[model samples]
Target chain A: MAQLTLVQALNEALRHELREDPRTLVFGEDVGRLGGVFRVTDGLQEEFGERRVFDTPLAESAIVGSAIGLALAGWRPVCEIQFDGFSYPALDQVITNLAKYRGRTRGRAALPVTIRIPSGGGIGGPEHHGESPETYYAHTAGLKVVAPSGPAEGYQLLRAAIRDPDPVIFLEPKSRYWTKEEVDAAAAGRLGQARIVREGTHATLIAWGAMTARCLQAAEAAAEDGVELEVVDCRSLVPLDVDTLSASVRKTGRAVVVHEAPLTAGFGAEISARLMETIFRDLKAPVLRVTGYDIPYPAAAVEAAYLPDLDRILTAVQKVLDY
Target chain B: MPSLRPDQLKELYRLMAFTRRVDQEAVALQRQGELTAFPPLTGQEAAQVGSAYALQRQDFAFPSYREMGVAIVRGVDLVEYLRAYRGDWNGGLYDLYAHNFGPIASSVGSHALHAVGWAMGAALDGGGKAAIVYFGEGATSEGDVHEAMNFAGIFRAPVVFFVQNNQWAISVPVARQTAAPIHRKAEAYGFPGLRIDGNDVLAVHAATAEALERARAGGGPTLIEALTYRLGAHSTADDPTRYRQAAEVEPWRAQDPLLRLAAQIDDEDFTRQVVEEVEERVRDLRTRLLSAPRAEPEEMFEFVYAEPPATLAAQREELRQWHS
Candidate 1:
């Protein structure tokens, strides 16, 4: 085990996939010599040569759309869509084309496309740089959505996404890119399995992507107020760790879903509704949700208020515990 | 003009005749309520058939909605092909890969990206296997088409962007579609562009063959704007008299691709045989479509995924129980 940053672990995962399969390719805007805008693909072009790891023109639709074609041609393409908000330009390809391929071909063809998006707002970036778009993808039928909270999951999830027979939207939490953690680079975690980061009894705090770390901090903060909380890192959003989440809620009898996106129609709502439906009888309180307000992703100055934080998560926990 | 051999010329005539017959039969079927709707390729048959005929057996082609002619020429199973228009399947035909064809995309200009992408993959395999994507003049307005050409040009992907400028995108005419010549737009994407008389089967074949060759040789993508006219309503559901004048279309009668071929070839018996064959094929399609068992409700769940996800399976059960 070694302590590597999230980007380093992702790089290692990509490096492993490239070395293992010649059909695997890495391409996006500034991915080659520039090593990507975020440098997640740093030294990839040098390490694997230009043919396998290369830069593409600044066209997200073509990047995502062509990967679909490449998959049909028996090649595994890992396309990077630069940033979260920028991925909107390619959403047409994602929603209309990528999601329809399997259904269109009637199970005859499988598109093994891994679309990597660096998302969430914490480091204070421009308008289009930081946005949480996981819900939009998770709602899509043919796509499997996963977000890593730390370096280890980053390494494991990206690798697994590459090997899956279906399309996977690997949402990389940009805030956690530098958060160093011990990682077994070889460990390819199964998709849709939740990891209970910390176990408690009074309440369950569930979060994914950038909010997972904050949720853990909130659990610690809640302990000071005589409240013990279970922190579940929801790694996979689409196939969802519903079983683990329901079990945790069944144990604690109180659950709070946290996310950086808006409150209404957020992925948190889906989780809360599921918990209410399946394990409502076990709940000591109504499932509470701590989420960003419904507003346009504000500029860098007011971005903090726009995203869910530790205090917000703790407040939701206290509210659920009081019930 | 690149001259066609005796057999090649005869084959070209046969494909056009077959396409024409199929167009007539499908329109007739739509009229008789056997089919829901169909986009007739009456005047644009040569544009579809010639370009599709140019591809190598392994080379892939992506077609827009009106490419029934291309599908017919490729020998895609007619019964399975009609299942799509029969409202049984969302995608047109089955076993697209076996015929070296992509699904007939309904969305405008979308399949261009798929074509360019498949072409890139074929190029990587390094065998001279090229790809062709067919779209209408209206589709050029879509951003994905521009991006598709851009990608194909930059990567030197082996693809032919065949634009059948068939005068109208439903009610909107070519004049409203673009300000400049359609073919010249390829220059912006750094590729060679050509405009051909799409109604002329020989010219369409020659231009398409040349582009496919250059693509196979790794010369990058080429844009071919086949200037043809749509002789019928956009679909059986459309009424064209509202937007266009009958007088305006009267002149294209002499320019019909099939009529031009009939003037070149003097084999009356061959034409009669081809008409007979097409009639037989249409009859066979009708019989199969009628006899085929309706897709079971459970069949929807089976093909959704290689191994169905938990939610999907659960939902399928919900549907099955609800139906029961």
Candidate 2:
């Protein structure tokens, strides 16, 4: 077991993959010498050589678009989006073409592209630097969306995503970049396998990426009130471990969905709807949700308040239980 | 450089005739409500065919929606070609990797980036092969094209950026696309740029061949701007009469690529035989596509993911239930 931060774990995974597969490449603006803004690709270019890991012009569309082309040309390319909020410039490439090309080719092509985005808020950055745009990728079919809230997940999922035979949007929680955990590089949890952090019969608390740690904290606080809260880390948002989610919700009979993205039309709505359809009759109450506001992510002053903390999560948990 | 051989010129003419016939058939089908829409590449056959002919089977190609000429020259099946026009799927039927040709850029200028990326990959793989990407003057205005050109320039990727300045981007004329010629735009990307007579098939062929050769020889990308005219409506749904006069159209007809190549193949019997053969092939392709069963709406779900997520599968089921 290696004790590493989320960023270090990501760097390790990238280095491992680049060394393991000669076809795997790492490229983005500042990824070569600068080691990425978050240093997730630290030392990759130096070890892998310039051709295997290089830097590109500061163009998001080109970075992602070329990665797709590289994949088509038999190269497994992992492109870093720099930040979550900066990912929109490549939305058309990610959505209109790259996401649909494999299907358009009718399974004749496999675009094994992995796009790395340092996502989520609470780091006290500007609007463009901090945001949760995983919904956009999750909404776009053909692309698998995954987010890792811890160092272990950060390492394993990055490797797994690089090996995936399709395009993957790997959202790393920037807030958790400094969070240290022991990561066993060889032990990889499956892509869509949601991890159950705590076993509780009172209510199930489901969250992912940056919000999973917050959900755990909320669960810890709730334990003082005799409320045994169960926490689940939804590692992969696209495939979505519905079976795990359902089994947890079925046991607890109440659920509180949490995320950093906005409330309306967020991925939470899908989870809520799916829970309703699958475990409606078994539930003690309706699936309650605690999420960010529908407006743009606010400034640093009120960001902590804006993000769902222990109080907010407990509020939703209480509502579900009272119902 | 040596002059064009008789065989090469004849091959170019054969492809040009085939593309022109395909355009005519597509237009006729559109008129008969057989297709959703058709983007006719009438007067610009030389630009697409000649340039595409320059590419080897190993060289990658990225084409805009108006490159039926390129597709035909690349050995794409006619039925599969028309299948896309019928709104069945993305254009053409071939192993995109094996054939080294991408699906037509559904969005105009975005494919330039893809070509640059592919070329960069090709260069990294240590191949003598190069890549070619086609678009129109209107596409040059798009930011993605500029970014792609920038990347290609900086990385020194082996790619040929082929722009067919067909005088208009729908209703917007060439004047609106840019003040200077589109080829000169490549100069900003720190690469060589050339303007060629797009209506002249021989000229288009020579320029593309030279540029591709330079690329394969470790030279960076080249931008070749082929100046031509769209002698028909922008698409089947478009009305050229709404914006332009017949006087503008008449002058381009005089510069038609097919008629210019006529003098090269002056034998009446050869022209007659080739024209008849291409027309017969076009008819057969259209008949096969029309006779084929229409694509099912639910079939769209199949390719949406490598393994369809339960969410999408359930949604597909919901849509089915809602319909019935």
Fraction of native contacts (fnat) of each candidate: 0.60, 0.70
Candidate 1: CAPRI quality band: medium
Q: TM-score of the candidate numbered 1?
A: 0.98
The alpha-carbon lDDT assigned to residue B136 of candidate 1 equals 96
Docking class of 2: medium
Tell me which residue pairs clash in candidate 1. none
Per-residue lDDT of candidate 1, residues A201-290 (tens digit) = 999999999899998888888788878889999999978878999999999999999998888899989999999889989999999998
Error of 1 at B45 (Å): 1.0
Fnat for model 1 comes to 0.60
Summarize candidate 2's per-residue lDDT along B123-165 as a digit string, tens digits.
8988698999999999999989999999999989899999999
The residue-by-residue lDDT of candidate 1 on B1-324, one tens digit each, is 367887887898888887888788888888988788888889998899888888889889888888988897788876677777777776764888889777768988888888888888888788488998999999999999999999988998999999999999999999998999999999998999999999988889999999999889889899999999999999999999999999989888779998888777878888788888878977877778778776678777765555677788899999999989
Off by over 4 Å in 1: none
